[model samples]
Target: AQRVTQPEKLLSVFKGAPVELKCNYSYSGSPELFWYVQYSRQRLQLLLRHISRESIKGFTADLNKGETSFHLKKPFAQEEDSAMYYCALGGRNTGFQKLVFGTGTRLLVSP
Candidate 1:
């Protein structure tokens, strides 16, 4: 069985402050990890992928295979960055597009 958990239901912070979104998962087999972000009115988009090791919109995430975690982080949070984020896991006998998503963490970036 595969499962993902985002500890915080909401994370509120000021602009320029550092932010961290906690995520933990449990899976028997190898799983592909991803962070998906949805800005104000924008559609949910991929923030980063553990496999790519790339950062998007000032945010980055690293997969800790040993800990079974993939936490999203950013050095400076921006007010415009306020949105909903979901930690997801993919890869099973299922298709690539099929993903299991966390409840989500609401990032409230205040000025």
Candidate 2:
């Protein structure tokens, strides 16, 4: 079985402060990691994918194969960035898409 873990359930940071969300994964095979965020009263959306190598909303995450980690980072955070963030692992068997998500971390950006 594969699992994704977000040790922090809640992260409170001031606006304009740097932030980093820790994520760890356990899997036998190669893992496809992703960060999904859900804003206030908004649907969950992809923040970043390990394969994309792109930054969204001023946040970026790089997959550390050796450590089995994919931590999200942002040089600066905004009040609007307050949201529920989840670390997800995507794997496949045959034609089926299997995913395991972390408990989720709620980021509170205080003004």
Cα deviation of 1 in candidate 2 (Å)? 1.8
Q: What is the lDDT of candidate 2?
A: 0.91
Best by TM-score: 2
lDDT of 1 by residue, 1-111 (tens): 678999999999999999999999987778899999998888999889999999888889999999999999999999988999999999873365689899999999999
Where in model 2 is the C-alpha error above 4 Å? 93-95
Per-residue lDDT for 1-111 in model 2, tens only? 688999999999999999999999988776789999999999999889999999998999999989999999999999999999999999772125767899999999999
Off by over 4 Å in 1: 93-97
Give the per-residue Cα lDDT of candidate 2 at 67. Answer: 93
Model 2: lDDT of residue 65: 88
Q: How high is the lDDT of residue 95 in model 1?
A: 60
lDDT of 1: 0.91
